[model samples]
Target: MRTRFTWGLTVNIMPPDYELRLKIVKNKIAGHEVSKLIAPEVLEYIANNCENDVRHLEGAINRLYAVTAMYSPKEINLEFAKDALKDYIGSSVYITNNIQKIQKAVAEYYDLTVESLKSKKRTAIINHARQVAIYLCKMTTEETLDKIGLEFNRDHATVIHACDKIGESLKKDEELREEINKIKDKIMN
Candidate 1:
């Protein structure tokens, strides 16, 4: 059997602008029968963060509603909006660093095994890679100085010294600084 079909015109729904985004959120909340008054600042915050996608804007509203459903009629303010969409907020740290993640990325970049990178061998190559890894761990992670030191099998003072060395190297060694920044971008991105 053969069937002939004609395609209909497509409509592209571009993301709403700031004021329109605020209206959309307000309308969605009202549609849900949520009577709580959302502060203008809260709407503006969501609008700014979720502007590129209408789905993101709606998801933000859903997140807020889901988190605060039990406290119906409670006004959604700036802090509440921030807390609801913490992951999407620019100020929030989205990439949580782990020692293993750092070690793997650095080792891969240096073409060394993670075991070799973490070992006691002090070859110039491995040592340099290890120091870079340690510095990245300090910069990207919230791990304690001692904790990072433990992962690298070094003392906290050693980790501190490596961080200082890398920091100073970054100040004067332009090529090395760029290389390190590239590594950091790889880690975070």
Candidate 2:
């Protein structure tokens, strides 16, 4: 003789919708105190690309944070996200070119753009960062100065100068040596 506890209206619990998934990821980021670390663009990327399991969002954000920490990139963007979360995103070579990877590491280290590094910007900061990137590309890869220069929108002369300048500077400038090492670290790992 069961009493009046019958089910009135059955309510089916479904997987979270898109907005909720986004909110869940965001809340997880906040909970991890890494809201400031993650880029807004990556939030949407996570929402769009992550599997149906919403818990994966938090794990993704955490993993992203850890990976970026090693590289110490300034701004985490879509390309970086795609590369860092390749396990989740699949084995696509978003950053296939070795030159591109060097440029990305150098740019992120200096908080500059690859385009700006390639441009004719002669400001002190941009110039130094460009030289550093050029040096790294030359040192790390077998690509000729002509090829590296083409990537940076310059000729072999510019690549040669950058290599000489940064190379000379590294001899005396301990800070520059450290910076270069950091950029290289990002590039390698």
Candidate 3:
């Protein structure tokens, strides 16, 4: 008989919840005596906004300290927090709405791979799918034409042409309009 051993251990690491996050923030503040330099509300703002990960929260705290140190402020307030963390908070939204998301949604809708849409193929189906992806990228993201083009290994003019072509096609083709709507609904929801 052969010896058999089975090990069962599962670890689920989730972001700390609201109260725990607040405690973590307070602990850091107390540890560094940051309360003397910044208001509790400002620290709370950082804790709530930087809720994605502990590392992000810690980074936000460090950034706040660095900025406050540079200015040598008597007190850091909500306005100061907003000014210091503008980029960090703003970028969280961009993380979700991006080209890869549009590409995946479009590829799944057309029953094609993302690679197929990105390829240089001139076949009607592949071209149409690529155009639709480009159109959706334009609709849903704030990324520039150059950025969208880079995603598909094309130039900005190619991206612009694809969007314009798809816009015109949607005006005349009811079936194509419905298909694009369904894909858009998937992405938006």
Candidate 4:
């Protein structure tokens, strides 16, 4: 008896265009082919072990666009369509760095370190600075609760609580918001 292979069985094959697009993205990002940057075995491993879903491929492409936007050459006006994929997934690093920078500026302005701000030992000045730092970090960082916890040496739950408290305060505290804006401007400049 002869067995027939279903159409579904043949659909796993990737088109040449998809492979070429992957190569172009890889080269643009890394100045090399994906195969050159990652080992052939590793590539094969990902191809074999991972889901062959179009969504997954699309996600990867989006991530590339995000990285490009974050680190794009200053002179280039990153074409919108070319970068739409990246914008969709969004970015954590960009948010994290902006937060970190703002935190650093606020700390410097108040003459404190981020560690000191996060610490439980708080005078009035320390408490205020800490609150500001928490607010800015929340506003600026795409850091998840777990990542923010690691940054402040707190548990994720604590980070969430801090964010909630600070967010509430920011809504009512116009003076504090103004100060934070000034500091952000300085740091961004």
Top TM-score prediction, candidate number = 1
In terms of lDDT, the best-performing candidate is 3
lDDT, candidates in the order shown: 0.70, 0.72, 0.74, 0.51
Estimate, for each residue in 1-189, the C-alpha lDDT of model 1 and write its tens digit.
223333555587766644566678667777565535676556645654565677888887888777777666467765666666676554423226689988988898888999988799999989889998887776555567799899989998989788777655654676765566566657666
Model 2 segments beyond 4 Å from truth? 1-97
Model 4 lDDT at residue 42: 22
Error of 2 at 70 (Å): 42
lDDT of 3 by residue, 1-189 (tens): 233323445577887754566678888888675677676556545654565688888888888888877887777876677677666664644224689988998899989999988898888888899998987676446567789999998998999799778756654687886787577667767
Model 4: ten consecutive residues of lowest lDDT: 41-50
- Of candidates 4 and 2, the better by lDDT: 2
> Model 2: what TM-score?
0.49
- Candidate 4 RMSD computed on C-alpha atoms after optimal superposition onto the true structure: 17.8
lDDT value for candidate 3?
A: 0.74
Q: Rank all candidate structures by their lDDT, best first, as comma-separated numbers.
A: 3, 2, 1, 4
Give the TM-score of each candidate: 0.51, 0.49, 0.49, 0.46
Candidate 4 has an lDDT of 0.51
Better of 3 and 4 by TM-score: 3
Kindly report which residue stretches of model 1 are placed more than 4 angstroms away from their true locations once superposed: 1-95
Query: Candidate 3 — which pairs collide?
Result: none
- Residues 75-162 of candidate 2: C-alpha lDDT, one tens digit per residue: 7865577678768544222223389998998899989988999999899999998998887776555466789999999898988788
Instruction: For each candidate in turn, give its C-alpha RMSD to the true structure in angstroms.
Output: 12.4, 16.4, 14.3, 17.8
